[model samples]
Target: MKTDPKQTLYGMSVQELQEAVKAIGLPAFRGVQLGDWIYKKNVLEWTEIKNFSKADIEKLAANYDLRSLDGSEASFSKGLESTKGLFKARDGHFLESVLISQRDRQTVCLSTQMGCKMACSFCASGKAKFLRNLTAGEIVEQVAWIQRKTEKRISNIVFMGMGEPLDNFDATMKAIEILIADWGFQLGGRRVTVSTSGITPKIIEFVERVDGRVRLSVSLHSSKPDVRDELMPINRRYNIDNLIQTLTEVHSKLKREITFEYTLIENINDSEEEARGVVKISLPLNAKVNLIPYNPIREMAAVYKTPSKERIERFTKILMDAGIHVTLRKTAGREIDAACGQLRLDREAVSAAGEPRTKNHEPREPAS
Candidate 1:
């Protein structure tokens, strides 16, 4: 297919890749073959795509990049369970994708963009300067990158890493499509969750586009509109009312109950009123609240501490008493700067300073 010479083919679905190759005069079946090579075989090079002539591969290469592990690096935590991968895009900027392994699940959280512009004060990724939204291929390749690290197949995919998944709407949705397609990653929609910081319209649009296959997680740090406004600037724009209304309307199409991810920052949002407010949000949409003990980013450490266990318990009790399902998320990967965008930030800082960030396998210091 006549494509942007700069475009990457790694993330395309069998249908799209077929069209791309067919557009360029390749046999239609080559798309299926390419899909097998990329998704099934996890091929890193076009040369690895056999049966096609070297010249034919070169022709395909002119219009697209294979986007293997090249120009990328990773840092693993001490146990080898958690890994933070930094993939350098064609533009030379790096983006983050994390592997968080616990119990039976090897979940890989993907970044939809290079850096983020969401500006959530408590999050490392949101604090970053916005670069650009990653292409669908770039987004999907994050999984393939993490997949190469371990033998266990990834159990889940979360758009909970660096950027606001909703903000990069098209690429995020396309990536999800590629991930869930049998010709691609073949992951069930239930295993993929797209977390948004309350972008109401996109929420509805995403619901319709995915048709309730993938899970939807909303970051409801505080149920109070005013407090949420302060915590997530996005709330100021979408607000609580708009979000609830949108989700309620979209409820008819959702395949699974929604999950509201609550970051429990000490004193900041752990009040009894906040817990009740979470109940209010959860009950209407048949949602469950996942209480996250806020992982403090060093830059915001003094202001945003994880609440004490007592306070977390008290908060969880409120939801439990209300019969609203909730789970307290365990903190992970502190040593490797497992917080979203922390590694990319460190990688860029070290590169800018002309030094290495850390010795291999050892966790590096997070941003100050």
Candidate 2:
């Protein structure tokens, strides 16, 4: 068995930081100083800390590596103003993060895993092979990198990028801790949303663990069991009925609104019947349905087309008439292949073909 390398200092909790300081023959107070520099100050390099002596700084640098995003591979959406950043992990695997700016709100979408295992037919993230789970530090670094680069406070965070967040349970929760900690990013729990593809057991565990402090969203593309099973493979294990039941229990216990992400894939799950099903499921759980018109992927574009505006309106009207709260999400960042896993796939393809990586802003084809 091969031993893993030491953990990065960026993502450790304050308590963990204290332990790290103890290991280095430093006073426990030094850990708090380290936490402040890394989390609150968002310093990417060890040398940025001024409180530590030069010898202490050098000693710290020897034991830990500062992992941050590669600015060279970052891409910005032309009209939308959304930015997609590619961070190369220490192991040389690349992960992607997106900074989405809409008017006053600045939201950063973070990936919990290098690639996704959930084979959602509509998502490009699942098209690539599942690589490995990102550690807590790696996840936190995504937000820190965006904050440092754009100089904008991230108002909201959504685990809606490249992977199923619930699948990477520990790291995701630990990252949340760093985000919500006073000495860290200091974001409110409500500002952070963890979206999952109906991971039943994990959802229950999340509710129990977090006590519904953070916001939750379910990727419920289709309400019909057969259609859902076809679109999201995880639905087979945690079916729609059970998922709804779990969410309903959570809503009753917490009295909070849950978000149901419904991706309208042309005629597939856009039918009025599916809309009715969405209303049925949402009403019971005090959930609001977010209607997303599908972003056409190159591989699945021939099979699936974005639903016409008319179709989307009709579906929204049906849900609204049924006394369900619904919002039609405007698709953004499509011009830059802003969909999850697309930028990584493009880079991988270019590397495999022995072509120089293009840094031009021209959008590759959409994924998801």
Candidate 3:
């Protein structure tokens, strides 16, 4: 099937809009006006452009198709708490996004790529290996799709879904820009965060460009070099020292507190000394630690066990006593593979007898 040329709306930046208007026999300044309407107005339909003449809207609509990534499949939490799902692209590649509704806020966790290259031991996203990155339009479409179904407007976004935001750095940042642009979603940059699995160089790249406007969450799953190297294979490439140096540079430049996500696995990295070591290595960056109890993943289930709630609380207290800011993040949507790296598009790749095979999970609910 031929992809729509009008899909240009997804990847177009402000300047590109100016060029587009001129090419379509319209005034260059009209591009700026149209951009303000489409992005700032958050209109997904070309007819929503009131400033343009009816003919102008017709021409644009004929050339470009404003697309939305509707929820193809949805799985809610056991009791209607959270929902997760695979949002299919026009090309049939599935990327994961979750709508998490809390009493105070509604946050959408979006994926930037079809699959992931960073094969962290505990994440299911890496199981299918890397696929192509999603365009900025594709990224933003996930939010628009979810907004239509929920009673509340999405208040925040987290780039902590299937793929590494930094791995698909260009598209990821563009999507963020679209979300925060005065002519776009108008969400504050501070409300949207991009989590990385230690893509060291990209961390610096993000810090420099963001000007302390956006939030950064680094996946620091382990403190020991060898353990981290084993748990997250990306560590072997970026390692801990180099990662620390880059993070320190970011902290120095931005003077912003970084968030370190430590997924505690039973008998893995949840000891008192391990918590102390986390503080020792992380203090230089003035980072806050987010202790995550391990979510049972298909591949890592045999090798890892979720730390008990008592253990998680004790570990968090150790950091707090050391004057470190810490929060033990309660796992959301546990009934439906709610872990950061648990969204994989392998539902049909199981055994045929219909007795659910436990490889990862036998297709749990999405967007719970």
Tell me the TM-score of each prediction against the true structure: 0.92, 0.94, 0.87
Residue 100 lDDT in model 3? 85
TM-score of 3: 0.87
Specify the poorest-scoring 10-residue window by lDDT in model 2.
359-368
**lDDT of each prediction vs. the true structure?**
0.83, 0.84, 0.77
In candidate 3, how many Å is residue 28 off?
Answer: 4.7
Model 2 / residue 226 / CA error / Å: 1.2
- lDDT (C-alpha) at residue 120 in model 1: 88
lDDT, candidate 3, 24-43, per-residue tens: 78888887886676565556
How far does residue 86 in candidate 2 sit from its true spot (Å)?
Answer: 1.1
For model 1 the local lDDT of residue 266 reads 92
Candidate 1 clashes: the total is 3
Best model number under TM-score: 2
Runs off by more than 4 Å, candidate 3: 1-6, 27-55, 68-71, 341-343, 347-368
Assess the local accuracy of residue 133 in candidate 3 as a C-alpha lDDT between 0 and 100.
85
